[model samples]
Target: MSGGDEQDGPKHEEEGKREQVTVVVLGDLGHSPRMNYHALSLSREGYEVNLVGYTGSKPQIEVLNDEHITLRYMRPPPNLSSLPRLIAFFVKVLWQAFFLFFTLLTGPCNKALLLQNPPGVPAMPVCWLYCFLTRTRFLVDWHNYGYSILALSLRKSHPLVYIYRMIERTFGRLAHGGLCVTKAMKIDLQQNWGITKVTVLYDRPAERFHPLTLEEKHNFLLKLSSQYPCFSSDSPDKTAFTERYADGRLALCEDRPALLVSSTSWTEDEDFSILFHALQDYENVRHQFPDHYPPLIVVVTGKGPLKVHYTSLVADRQWSHVVLLTPWMTAEDYPKLLASADLGVCLHFSSSGLDLPMKVVDMFGSGLPVAAIYYPALPELVKHNENGLIFKTKEELANLLQDWFRGFPQETEIKETYYDFYKNIDEFRKLQWHSCWTCNALPLFSYGKQKHAKE
Candidate 1:
C-alpha cells in the first residue's frame, strides 16, 4: 500500500451497519491497469472501495473521487542498482507492509482485502496474515502468477523462484477466493495448487472505445495533430506523411490511406522484433502489388528501456511508411486513435504465458479488426478470421497482412466486415462483462458478506 493524503475517514458506525466494505490493495499503481479497472468497477457497484497503491508520476487520486471511494498513495521505491538496490527493495517492502497492516487493521469491520498479485511475495503474506488475525476475507486477483513472471528473468529452479512459488501456493490457499484474467490461469490454479475458489474475469475496454463517424474521425485527427506537434502532417519534416482512405479492396484511393495502429510497452515479452520483421517483409512485397497503396503504419507506445534501441532499429531500417510516436495521449484521445484505425496489430506475448493483454480488448471495442500475435491464452479472446486473425510467426503475420490487404479493398465490403466483426465483439463484450461482474465479482464479495454475517 502507498501512502498519501487520506480522503474520507472510515465510518465506524455506518460501516458496521452495512454488510461489508472492501479495501483494494495494489502494489504497482503506475502500470496496474487491471487494478484500476477493478477499483472503478467496485466503486460503481456502490461498494465502499479504499484504493491503496503507489501514486507515482501519474496521480490517480483526483479522478477516483467518489462518495464510496477513498484514495491512499504509497511512495515509490528507489531505483538503485546492484546489491544495495536489492537490499533497499526488501526494506521498502517491509516498510510498506508495516503501514498497510495498520491501515487494514484500523479500517472498517466486516472487511474484505482484495489484493492484486505480482509483488505477491511481499504483499500476499502480509495480507493473508492480516486477514487471519482480523478474521477478514482475503481474495487474490491474479493477473499473472508472480513466480512464473520472475522465472522469465531467473532460472525456474532458482531458490528465489522456489520461494515465490512457496509464498504463492501457501498464501493462495489461505485466500477465500481468487479472480484471474484468463480461464487457463484459473484451471492451472485449481489443478496445480488446489485453489478451486477462483473465477475468470476477462478484461474489458472502457466505454470510450467505440465506433466513430467519418467526420468525427477527421476532427479527431486534427485535434490529435494539434495536441502532438510531431503528429501534424503540415510540419515541414513530416511532409511525406499523408492521410488517405481505403477505397474498399484494401487499396488506397486518391485521398484515402489505410491506417494501421499498434500500441506497445516495448518490453521483452512482447517480441516487437517479430512485428518489425513482418513490416519489413510487407514493405519488400508491397511494391509487387501495384493496385494497393502502402499503409501509414502508426506505432503508439510508452517510453521503456528498449524504446531507444527499438527506435534506433526502426530509424536505421528507414521504412518509408512507418511512424513511431511516443507521446502519451489523454484517456479521451487514446480510444479515438484506435477508432480511426482500419486495423490493429497486437504484439503482446505474456511473460508468464498465462496473462492476456488488454490492448486487444481496446482494439475490439473500437470495432477495429485485429492481427494479434498468437500465444496459448490468446485464442480464448481472438478467434482466427472470426473477430480477428491470429498468427504464430513473422512470416505468418506478414502473409496475413498481405491477405487482408488483397481481400478487402472496397468501401461496402469494409463496412460490412467491420460491422460484422463489431457485432460479434459487442456480443462477446456483453457476455464477458456479465460473467465478470454478475457471476464472478458479485459472488466473491457476497461470500465475504455472508461469512461476516455468519460470524
Candidate 2:
C-alpha cells in the first residue's frame, strides 16, 4: 500500500468507531423528545450517547432500548418555593450549575456536548464552559429564545432580561455549531445571537407515531376504558370505537362520540381561557341541538404549572353533552392516544413568535387534523383549510368545533373536509424524526468528532 493510504486507514477506521457525545437538558428527560431523538440518532450514527437530565416522566421505547445510550440522572434541586420569586430562581440555578458541571466534568463526552436552550440560565452557560475547557465541540439546539420567554413574565426592559440576552449572545457566538427548530429562528440566531452555524432542523414525528389501524384503535380504546368508562360502548362489553353483531362480526361503530385531544403545557403563551370558553360554547350547541352534535369527549394531556388552575375553573361548569378529561399518560401510550383521537387541538402561542409547536408535529404524525390557535409561525405547520385549521379568537374556535361535529357520523360538508385533511396528513406522515435528524443533525456531530480526532 502507498504511504498515505496506509497512514490514513487506521485513523479513518478509528474515527468511525463508537465515540461519545453527551446531550444535556435542563428539563425533564421524558418531556424533551427532541433531545431524546438527538441521542437516538447519535447512537444509530455510531456514537455512544450519555443522556443527562432531571428525572420525572417515562421516556419512549426506542430510547429505553438503545444499548449505546446511557441515561444519567441529576439530583433535583430542592423546592424553594417559600422564598421570593427572584431568590428562588437564582438559588435553583446555582444548584443546577454546580451539579450539571460536575456531571459533564467527569463524563466520557470527549467529542461534543449537545444541549437544548430556554432553561438557558444554567445549561447554556454550564455546557459552554464544559466544552470550552475540554476543547470539545459545543452544539446548542435552539428550541426558542430564553430571553423572549423571560419577557413573557418580566418586561423587555427588565435588567435581568437584558442581562440574560447578553449572556445568550455571548455564548451563542462562542459555540462551534448549532441547530434550531425553525427557519425564522435560524435567521434570528444569525442576526442577533451571533450563532453563524445555526441550522434549521424542523421538528418531525418519531417513528412510533402513525395512524392506527381500526383494530389498533379498538384495542387502545378498550385498554383506556378500564379507567375512563366513557371509552366503553353503551353495551359496556365493547369499546366505543367498536360494535359486535349477533352474527359474530365486529366492526367500527357508526355513531361513536367524537374524540378530540389537546396537549397543553399550561404556560403563559398558551391561553387556555380561550379553550375553556370554546368548550362551553360547544356544550351549548350540543345541549340545544342534541340530534346534531352528538356527545363529545375532549381529553387534555401533559403536565404544567397552570393545570390545577384551569382544571378547577372548568370543574364548576356542568355540561350535559360535553366532557373534559385531564389524564397523565405513560410515554408508550401517548402516541396511541394521539392516533385514537379524531382531532387534535394546539394552544401554543410561541413566546418568540418564531417557533412552531412540536405537539402539532406529533398530531400530524398521528394522522389527526389539528385546530391550532393562531400565531405567526403556526402557519408553517398548520394550514387553514388544508391539513388543519387555525383560529385567533374564542368565537372562531367555537364555530370550528361546532361545525367539525355538526353531523353525527352522517353526510355533511364538514365530514368531507375532515376526509381531505386525513388524506393530506397521510402524505405528511411520510417523513419521520430519525430521517430528518440523519439529514440535518448527524453531519454536524460527525464532522466535529472527526475533525477533533484528526487534529
Candidate 3:
C-alpha cells in the first residue's frame, strides 16, 4: 500500500506487535519538527521510545507520554549568551552521552539516533566509541552538507572544518547507517566521505499537515489577517478588507492575491540577509502589480537574540514589508498559518550546499508556491517556472517579480504543476527522501548484518 494509506492500517494491532526498542533522541526537541514527527511516529507504532532533550515551556513528558513514550529532559546550564550557550550545549551533550552509556548498560537500547549539532563533533568520537563497545548500532542524523555549511558560516577556516569533516568521516565510517535528509547528502557521503550506508529520509508532511476544510482554511486566514498590523482591524465599518502599510507607503491594491509567507528559526549561519535584500529589490512587484503581488510581507518567526536586531534591520530599511512573529506559536496553529499563505520562500546564500531545508516540506504541506535560491536539493522539489522560481541573484528576483506582477500570466499552469507534484509525490524517485529512522539505520537487533524490507 502507498504511504498515503500507510498510517491508517494496523493501528489497533500496533500495541500488540510493539517492539521493545529504546531510541535516545539527542537534539533541540523544542525546535526540531523532524524529531518530534519521528518520535511521535515511532510511538504510534507502539515502540518503546525514550527521548533526551532540553527543558522548555513545552512539557517533555507531555508530548511523549501522550504517545506512550518515555522522555528525559536535560536541565540547561545558567549561561544564556552565545558563548555560554555553546559551552552549555557541549556539557549537556556529554552528560547525555554518559547517560546513554548507562542506559545502554543497565537497560536495553536498540538504536541511538544522534541529531548532530555543530561544535558537538568532539563528543561524537566518544559516542561512537560507546556504540562500538556496547554493540549498540548508531545512526548519525546528517542534516546538511557539513563542509559546505562550515565553509559558508564560519569566519575563519581554521582546523575546525577539517576537524568536523574528520569527525563526520569517522562517524560515517563507523555509523551503522547515516540518515541523510536528501539525495545530495547521501551522494556527498558516498562520493566525498566514501561511506556506503546512507539513506535519504526527508521531511514528509505529517498527518497534521493534511488538507484542511475550506472553512478551516478561511477561518485561519481571518485570524491571521485580523491580528496582523498590515491587515485592517480598527474600521469594522469598512465594506471590504483592504491591505495597506502602517506608513501608508503601500496604497496600491488588487485581487486579494494568494499570500506568500514564510517563517523560520534564525541561525547565525543562515543568510536571511540575502532573502531580505532580494525582497527589497522585488518591491516593484508590489507597486506595479498590486493585483498579483502577495502581501508584500515576510514574517520572521522563531526565538533568538538576533530577532530584535533583525527586525531593526527590516524597520531601519523602512521595510514595512516584513513582520516579526518572534514569540512562541502553537504547533496546531503553525500549519494553518502556513497554509494560508499563497507562496513560500526559502533562500540561502551561495555558500549553503544542497541539503533540503525543513521549511521546504513545511511549505509543500502548506500547498503554497515556492521561491527559493537555485540550490541543489531544492531544485529537486522546485522545477523552475513550474512550481516555483529560483533566483541566482537579487537582479534575477527583480525580473521574476516583474513577470509575477504581470498577473503571473502563467500562474494557473504553474500552480497546477505544483499541486500535481505534491499530490503524486510518491511517483517521483525516492532519491531525495528517506524513511524516518527505521529505513536509514540498522536496528540494534541486527548488528554486523545487512538486509532490506519493503516499506
Candidate 4:
C-alpha cells in the first residue's frame, strides 16, 4: 500500500472506537434532574452522551438543545391491575431487564454506563451483566439505597426487602466506580455494601436556577396570572407581582403578597400534612396579629398522586390570611418561579435519611431562604441560621414562616437575619452544578476509558 493508504487505515481504525457514555435512569427523564445534569456536563466536556430513561414529561430544553447528547427512551411495562400485585411486579421487572439489556447492547460507542439507583430491582443486575459482557465500565449513582426505599412501604423484615438488599449489595460491589449524594451514604456503602470506590457528588442547582431580575419576575408573574388567577390581584387591573409606573416601567405591586414556594411528589416520603398544619397555625397567627404579617401566596408546584386528596382538603378550609395555590407547571417555568419566590419550604423526609433534598439545593441556588423539615442528613446541606432554617414540628415551621416575612417589604431588626441568606447563597451558588459534577463525578466516569480512543 502507498503512504496515503497506510495513513487512511490508521485513521479508520481510530474512528471505529467508541468513546461515548450512556447515562441511564429508570424514572422520568424530566424529573431526574441529577442524571440530566450529568448528561449535560458530559456533553460540555466534549463527550457524546446517550441519556436513557422512561419517556414521560419532556426533558428540560437544555438536553434537547445540546448537539452532543441524544435521549433514548424506554417504555415502562404496563402493570396489569387485574392481576395480583406480585405477579404484576414480576412481569414488570422481567420486561425492564429485557428492554434495558438490549438498549445497552445496541447503544453506539457505549464506553461506560452510569445508572441512577432506586428502581434497582432489575437495573442493577441488568446493568452489571451488560458491563460484564461488553467489557464496558459500570458506575452507580446512589441517590439512595433501593432496598431502603422499598422498606418505606414494605416492612423492613419482608422477604422481598431482604432479597432486594442481597441483590443490590451483590451487584453494587461490582461497579467500576460510584457516586453518592453524601458522605454518610459513602460510608454506608463501604461498611455495609463493600463498595469502596465512591465519590460524594452532592446535588447543586442547574444554571437555570438563579435570582430573576425585577422585570423578569414581573413578566413571569404576568404569564403565570393567565393560568392561575391566584397570582393576580382581586382587582381587574394589575397582577399580584407588579404594578405600572407613569413612564411605562413596571415595579413590584405595592403591598404585594409574599411568595412562598415548595414542590412535592406527594409521595410517602414527604409528609405534606406538616405543611398543612403549618398553614393552619399561620392562619391563627394572622387572626391574632392582623397587620404584622404579610399575606402569603404559597404556591406548591408539581403533579403527583395525592395532589387531589390535598386539593379537596384545601377547598374545605376557611383560610382568609393565607391562599394556597397548587399549580402544575412545565419544567421550564419551575426555576423562574423558584427565583421569584421570597422563601421556600421542604418537607422531604429521606427514606434512608442519608440523601439530601435536591429542592433545597435549587432553592438556595435561586437565592431563596428555606424552612426545611429536619432530618438526620439535612445539616450537610442546610446550615441553620445561615442559609436556611431547620424545623421539626409544624408549630416550629409556622413560627419560622411568621418570623421570615415578619414586616412585609419593610425591613425589621428580626428580618435583618434574612439578608444573610442572600450572602450565604451567593457563596453557595459560586459552586454551580457543572463545577460540582466536574470536581467529584467526572473523574469516576472518565475511568477505564482507552486513552487512544477519540474523545
Candidate 5:
C-alpha cells in the first residue's frame, strides 16, 4: 500500500551534506486515508517525512517502513484500559505537542505541517505562540475546518461551541496558509476568518485504487456473488439483490432505483436503522405502487471489527431488501458496487468536519447520485441535486428516496463538477509545489483554500 517510484525519491547526497529539508506532519491516523496518502507522497517527493499518528489496534508499520517515512505512534497506556477513549485523547495531544517541541528544538526546525485533531482548540494558542517565538513557518492543513463541524455539532450558543469558534479563528489568523477539503470549505474560511490564499487538495483515492480490467471484474463479481449468495439470483440467500436492484446489477437496469451506503469506519451513527425502517415502510405499501416499485440495496465496504449496531432492527425486520459486504474486496470492486446504485448515502451523527471522507469521492467517481444529511464540508463536494441530494429529516429523507425512486428527483442529469476537481492527483502534487512557501530556505507547501465566510 505504500511504495512510490524510486526515482521520485530525493537526490543522492554527498558526504557531510546536510539533509535538504525535514517536514514533520502531525495528522489523524486512525482509519485516515488523508494522513497515510499525504505521508507516503511527501516522503516519495524527497522530503524526510516524519509522521506522527494513531493506527488503531493494528499498527501500520509496513507503510512507514516501505516509504522510508519515520512514524511516531500514540499507543494508549496499558493501565488506562478502563478510560481508554478520554485517556487516549489526552495522550495523543501530549505526544504530538511533545514531538512538535522536540523537532523544533533539535531537528532542522524550519516548517511545521499540522492536520487538525482534538486539542486543536487548545493547541492553536500554543502553536501560534511557538511559531511566534521560534519564527518557524507554521502551515495549518485545515483538512476539515474544525470549527465548522463543531458549530454544526453544537448549536451556535453552546459554551463549547463558542470556545471552538475562538480556537478556530485564532488558528486561522496565525497560520501562514490553510488547506480545506472542499471548495465550499475554502469559501467558508474567507468569509468567516478572512484567511485568503488558501489551497484546495481533495482526499484523492489511493494509487492502489484504479480502474478494473474486464477479466478482473468477472472474477471480482464471481467471488463476491459466490461469497454472498444473495447476490446470485439462482441461489436463495434471502438477501434479495432484486429488491436492492430489480435487474441485480448496476449497469443491467437503467433508471432502476437503488441505494448505496459507503462506510469507512464501522460505527452505528450513520443511522442505517432509520433508513432500514423507512425502507420497510416502502415495502409495506408496495401494492399501491406496483408499477413504480423502486429497488433498494445497501452496499457497505471497509475493514474493521464486524459490527451491526442495528442488530435488533435486522433480526426483527426483513433486511431482504439489503445487501451487506465486508472490507476484504479490492478498491476496484467499489466502483462496480456503486455503478448499479442510483443513490449513495453518506450520513453520520459525528460532527467532525475535519474529514469529508474518501467515500464521497468514490460515490462521485462511480457517477452515482448521492444523498447526504448535511455533513460539514460535504456540501462542498455534493451540492443538493446538482451532483446529488442532501436532506435533514426522516420524512424529508424518505420523500427524497421515494422521489428518486419514482424518477422525478430535481436534476435531469447528475453533475460531475466535484469529480473534475479530483480527476488526477498529479494536479494536487503540482499544486503543492506551486503553493510551496520558503521557510528557513525549505520549500513548504501550504494547502489552503478560500470561500465566503459564514457566521
Candidate 6:
C-alpha cells in the first residue's frame, strides 16, 4: 500500500518546503520498532518521511496521525516450488529490492534514503546504487549485522555467508552514515570494518509507556482477563495467586495478582528454554514459601514459525501458572499491559554478540525492573543489581525470583534501592531522547548538518 502527495517530477528546493526522507526496511513495519521510531521522529521534526516496508496483512498508510509520514508496504512473494528454499529466498529478496529501487528512484531525487539493516544484503546495495545514481544521501541504521544472523543458519565458511558479509561491509562503507544500537557495535564497525561515520543510537520507548496508577492497573488487568479467558479469576487456583505488593514487599495484597511480563519475538536467537526452565525452578522454590503469592507469568510474543512448537511445549509442560499470548497487540493495549506489570523479563541473546534488545528499553520506560539474560552487550544497558538484574544461567534467574518473592526484613530499604534505580533510568531516558537526533545522526550526514546549523 503506497499513496501520498506525489511530486509531479523531482522535487527541488522550493521555498518553505520541508526536506524529504525515505525510510526503508525490508522487514515488517509492525515488528520493526527502531524504524518506526525513526519515521515518527523525523516526521515530528518537520521532515516528510516516506516509510517503505512489507506488511503481511493490510498496509498501514498512516501512523500517529502525522501528515508528513506515509507508509508504503510491499506484499511478500508467494512460495516457489521449483527452486531450492535458499535460492527462492534470494529470488524474493531480489524482486523486492528491484521494486524498492524503482519506487525510491521515481519518487524524489536528492532526498535522504534511511535504510534499516538485516535484510541488508538485498536493501543496502540497491539503496547504495540509488544514492550513487541520484546523488541522494544513503544512511543505514544497523540493528544487528545481517551477515552474522545468516551465519547462525549457514556455516561461516559457506560461500553464501561470505558473499553476504562482503556485501554488507562494502555497501556499509559506501553509505553516507550509519547508526548502531550499541557502543560495542559502533566499536566493532569502526575497528573491524573501518566505518568511521557510525554513531551509537540507543533505542527509546514511546512516551506513552510509564508507571500506571493503581486504578489503571486494575482496569488493565480486567481488560486482559476479559480479552484472554485463561487469565480470568474464575480459574480453579484463583486463591493461590494473589497480587504481591508492588513496593518491594512479597506479601499478598488484595485480589490483584503480581504480574510478570515478557515480550519476545520467539526466534532462535532468543533462548526461551532458559526462561521456561527458570520458571519451573521458581515454581518448586515458591512452594517452599507458602505465605508468598504465586505470580502470574505472561509471555507476550509475536507469531513466528516456532510459535506452534513452543506452544506445544508449554501445553505439554502444563505450566498452569504461565500464559503464553501469541500474535501482536494493539498499540494502546501493549503499553498498558507493560506499565501494569510488576517486573519484565527479557530473554534475547543477540544473534550477533554486538546487538542489544529493544524490549528491555520498553520495559525500562514503564519503570519496570527487568531480569535480562546476560549477553556481551547487555551490561551497557542493564546494570546488575542496580537498574535491573542480569543472569547468565537458569539457576541465577531462579535465585533472583526467589529473592524477589522472599520478602526482605528491610523492605523500605529495598524499595529505596528500586526507586533510585528507576530515577536513574528516567533521567537517562530523558537525556537520550532529548539528544537523539542531534548527537546520533547530525554531524555525519549533509542534511543532518544543515538541520543542526539551522538549530
Against the true structure, candidate 4 has what lDDT?
Answer: 0.84
lDDT of each: 0.70, 0.83, 0.56, 0.84, 0.53, 0.73
Candidate 2 residue lDDT tens string, 114-198: 8899778878889988898898899889898898999999999999899888888888888888899888888888787667898
Per the 3 Å backbone cut-off, how many clashing residue pairs does candidate 5 have?
A: 15
- Off by more than 4 A, model 3: 1-18, 57-66, 77-123, 145-156, 233-254, 284-295, 317-328, 349-352, 408-455
List, residue by residue over 1-455, the lDDT tens digit for candidate 5.
36645764454223332232233334445455555655555555445555655445332444545545666554432344566654664665565666555544554443455545343654566566666776755666666545545566456687766777777777777777656566766777788778885666666544333344434444454556667654455533222233223454332224333555555445444556556555666665443674565455556565433245554455566545444444444544556766545566776554555356567666555555567777656665667755667777766776766666553122323534434423432233233321232221123342211122221
| TM-score of every candidate relative to the true structure | 0.85, 0.92, 0.75, 0.92, 0.67, 0.86
Tens-place lDDT per residue, model 6, 1-455, is 23433443223334467777888988788778778777766655556778888875432334535566777766666767699978887798778877887777677654688899988868899989988988888899999988888888888788888898899999999988889989999999999998978889888776777777755665566666666775566642232233434463333334344567787767787777777777777666556664554545564655556667777887887755555566477667777777766678898888788888788888888888899998899998899878889999988887876676455323423766678677777775675452586567644444655787799
Tens digit of per-residue lDDT, candidate 4, span 1-455 = 01121221322135554258899998889889999889878876656789999998877777888766788988788858998978887898899999988888888857789999987989999999988988888999999888888888888999889999998899888899889999999999999789999999989888888899888887788888888777877644368878756677777765777889999988768888889988888888878887888777889987778888987887799688889988776777889989999889998899888999999998888888889998888999999999999999988987888887777766543466777877999999998787788788877766544343545
The alpha-carbon deviation from the true structure for residue 248 of candidate 2, after best TM-score superposition, in angstroms, is: 4.5
How many backbone clashes does every candidate have?
16, 0, 5, 0, 15, 1
Q: Which pairs clash in model 2?
A: none
What are the RMSDs of all candidates, in order?
5.4, 5.2, 6.8, 5.4, 8.0, 5.4
Residue 105 in candidate 6, Cα distance off native in Å: 2.0
Q: In model 2, where is the ten-residue run with the lowest total lDDT?
A: 1-10
Error of 1 at 331 (Å): 1.8
lDDT of 4 at 334: 86
